[model samples]
Target: MIKLQHIYKIYEDEHAKHDALNDINLEILEGECVLLRGHSGSGKSTLLSLIAGILKPTKGLLEVDGVSLSKVPDDAATLFRREHIGNIFQKYNLIEDLTVLDNIITPLIPTDLSYSDVLKLADEALEIANISHKKYNLAKKLSGGEQQRCAIARAIVNKPKIILADEPSANLDLNLTMEFIEEMKKLKSHNKTIIIASHDDLLFQSKIFTKIIVLDKGKISDIN
Candidate 1:
């Protein structure tokens, strides 16, 4: 339920304009999993940011589940993201001093849910991400895989419809990358629309990915 039409992302400084993405046209259906595969600075992250409403496109239309994101107000886009998007970044964006449960429940803090409800969500998310055993541990004490699992738990705690992961396998070893692939498969089975941006062969090689979109020099090089 994602569509980009003639999309362009241009960053402008005082002296020059650089295009991060140019004339990007794509469609991702509900429940479909796609991989945005490219080297660094090839617009994969920029495209994912556009899809997640973190950055607006400079030209053309972007719609998620029929809502025109490019036209939405800033607050509206934030709300829409809260309601629909789940993100996993390469860096485990967890607070070092916060406990795992606290970190996972951070996203739910803005909602009107009761404390008990928030705890329930955090617990459930931890279970899904296989990080429940670290519930009370400080984030800084966790291992790399544990930290990544915590990030995944936090992202999914909101029960978002679309999952956007940028370079999820970038920091992990082969074994941990395989663990991530398994998690992705589970999410795909749950009918969540998934898109990942990475150059890691572990993710792109998986048969779970319905399609792979390759970007090079700010343009789409191939879609397979």
Candidate 2:
């Protein structure tokens, strides 16, 4: 579902030119769950960003779900990403003032779905994530694990084909980290392509991960 060939991302400014990813080649298939394991400055996050259209490579070819991401126009790519990719952030990225249900449906606001349809979608997502009980509560009132569940609901509400989770367990304790592992299992059951960039050993140790790709010095070092 994702392909990157000779991908190099170089950030250029007036003062310096820094390479974030270099000479990377990867191919991920449909319904495959891949874990990206690396320390800081290893380009794991950069690779995820490139796949999610959050960053563009300086010189390389990238394709996701068959589109030439490197050549797609910005406006088109944004819409395409919204339609095909679901992003789960480390901080949850919820609006503090919004209710859980409202935050879950925020991504649907851009679509042509009706109010009731949006509510239904959010309801289904909440149910899938086992967070329906907190649907009416404000985001700020929820616990860390609850907030993470809310983020998961918001992400899959669109039924995205690809799920990009960046350091999802970074903030959670062992218990909550285990909750995320269960959630990953559920997402995989739905046949969604999952890519995770993480430092958490819990995820790195999970048996559900089809492959573990290691990165170092801005390049892929090994795939286990």
Candidate 3:
């Protein structure tokens, strides 16, 4: 479902050129759950962003869900991401002023979905994320785990073909982490591709991933 070939990402500043990703090549299939393990500055997040089309690769070819992201125009890329990708971040990224239901409905705003249809989608997403009880709560009022679940609901509300999570279990305790993983695993039943970038050892120990890619020094150092 996703492929990257000889990907290189360079950041230029007034005095230095930083290589965030270098000579990386990888492929992830549909309905696969892949874990990316790396320390800080190791380019794991860079790889995810590249696949998500939030950051353009300085050089390389990237294809996601059969679309060549490297060749897509900016406007098309934006639309492609919105239509096909769902991103969950360590920070949750919820809108502070919106209620839980509102945040979940945010992504569908640009679509032609009727209000009732959007609400139905949001309700189903909240139920799937197990955040239905908090639907009326303001995003800022929820606890960390609750907030993260809300973020997940928001991310998957559109039923994107790909799910990208960056440090999704970072803030949760063991139980919550397991809960989150279980929720993520359920997506596989629907044939959604899942990629998680995390340094958490528990994820590696879970034996749930189809593959694990370890990144070091901006390159893929190991795969298992």
Candidate 4:
């Protein structure tokens, strides 16, 4: 579950203030697959970051799974993100030299799980992302699709409740993008709350999305 009430995200510097999001009020129920469709600078990414606990709203409340992220300290937010959020960025944020398996397990390094347990989770995630064969390959050596699979594996390895993907298909081909849509469908079947921010037409046309929200400038322009 995610809720945002009168949320405002403003970036202010010495000379000006830019509003990334303004007066956003939204609530996403559990297990819902939602699409955030907008052009560049439409506040889609900002909303995802706020829900993922990576950015605190400058005004109003933000709650994810009942936790008030806007009021928490940075460390607490980080912990909450690790525990409940899976973020897939547009640019695959993998360590260049690390192997795919190592990268997948990186998020688990901070937990108290034993080495074997960590490996178990990583292997399961790799299987789900269909990147098990490339598990030992270096991140820098993987192809675009392979790298995308690696990123997905890493994000879901924690088994997070809410999956936030920002422009996930930006680098993939049509076939790979279709594969991603299927993957998202699988996750939805597993009852995960999925939110994706992208302008991809394929996603908008897909049947998996339960709700489609279009943002204009810094506000919700339409919801379907």
Candidate 5:
């Protein structure tokens, strides 16, 4: 579960200060599939970053699972995020030269797991992402959809309890978008808390989303 209370994220320069998020408060329960719907500059991505512990709130409280992320030290937050959050970026950040399996195993390298255990986890993640056949292929050689699947596998290789996806369908065609929906459904079935920040209508129309929260001008405009 995740909770935010009176959260604010502000960016300041010498000349001006801008609030990326303002007085945003939300609570997402465990195993819920949630959508953050808004146009560009609505602070959706900023909200996701805050929840993932990549950005500390300028003010207010943020708690994921049971820990207060807003108050934690940066190193502690990083470790907590590594253990609990699976982040899927819009750009599908993969090492171009690495094989799919190797890319998936990269995150586990920093942990205490042995090489064999890392491979085991990567294998399981590949199976879940439906990309096992491409495990040996170079990341740059894969098609867009294949790369996306590889990214998904890498994100979830840690078996994170929460999955945060930012504009995951921005590059996909309709068919690939559908594939993403199906993949997210698989993650949901495993009781993963899924929060996606996207304006894509395809996701808005999907039946898998448990709640849709609309944002405008860095504030919650509506909730459905």
Candidate 6:
């Protein structure tokens, strides 16, 4: 469902140029879960941003679900991301002032769906993420695991086809990490494609991944 060919990303400052990604070539099939493992500055997040159309590649081709993101206009890319890609960032990125349900329903606001339909979707997403009971709580009052689950619920509220997670377990305890991983596994059962950028060894140890890609110094170092 996703493809990147000869992709390159470079950031230029007045003093120097840094290559965030170099000649990346990757393909992820539908219903597949792929893990991207690497240390800091390894281009894992850069690759994810490229795939999600959050960043335009300096060079190369990118296609997600047959739409060529490399050629898409900025507004089109934004629309495509909203409709097709679900993102879980390390910070959870929840709106602090919004209730859990409100935050989860934010993405549905731009759609023409009725208020009842939006609420239904948010409730269903909370159920899938196992956070339905906390629907009315303020986001800041939730625990770390609860907040992470809330992030997942918000991401999948639109039933996006692809889920991109960047260091999702970075701030969690062992138990919460396991819980998050299990929740991700459940997503595969629903035929959603998941791509995770993490250095967590436990994730690599899991046999659920269809493949694992390692990045180093802005390029792919290994694939298995």
lDDT for each residue of candidate 2 in 104-137, tens digit (9 for 90 to 100): 9999999998999998989999999889999999
Q: Of the candidates shown, which would achieve the greatest lDDT relative to the real structure?
A: 5
TM-score of 5: 0.98
**Residue pairs clashing, model 3:** none
lDDT of 4 by residue, 155-220 (tens): 899999999999999888899899889889888987999999989998889888899999998999
What's the TM-score of every candidate structure? 0.97, 0.97, 0.95, 0.97, 0.98, 0.97
Candidates 2 and 4, the one with greater TM-score: 2
| Cα lDDT listed for each candidate | 0.92, 0.92, 0.90, 0.93, 0.94, 0.93
Off by over 4 Å in 3: none
Model 5 residue pairs with clashes: none
* lDDT: worst 10-residue window of model 1: 198-207
Off by over 4 Å in 5: none
| Best TM-score among the predictions, by candidate number | 5
Q: Scored by Cα lDDT, where does model 2 land?
A: 0.92
lDDT of 5 by residue, 58-159 (tens): 999999999999999999999998899998988899999999999998878879998888988999999999999999999999998999999999999999
CA displacement after TM-score superposition, residue 220 of candidate 6 (Å): 1.2
- C-alpha lDDT of residue 15 in model 6: 100
lDDT of 6 by residue, 96-150 (tens): 9999999999889889999999988998899999999999999999999999999
Question: Looking at model 5, how many pairs of residues clash?
Answer: 0
The clash count for each model shown is: 0, 0, 0, 0, 0, 0
Stretches off by above 4 angstroms in model 1 are: none
Candidate no. 6 TM-score:
0.97
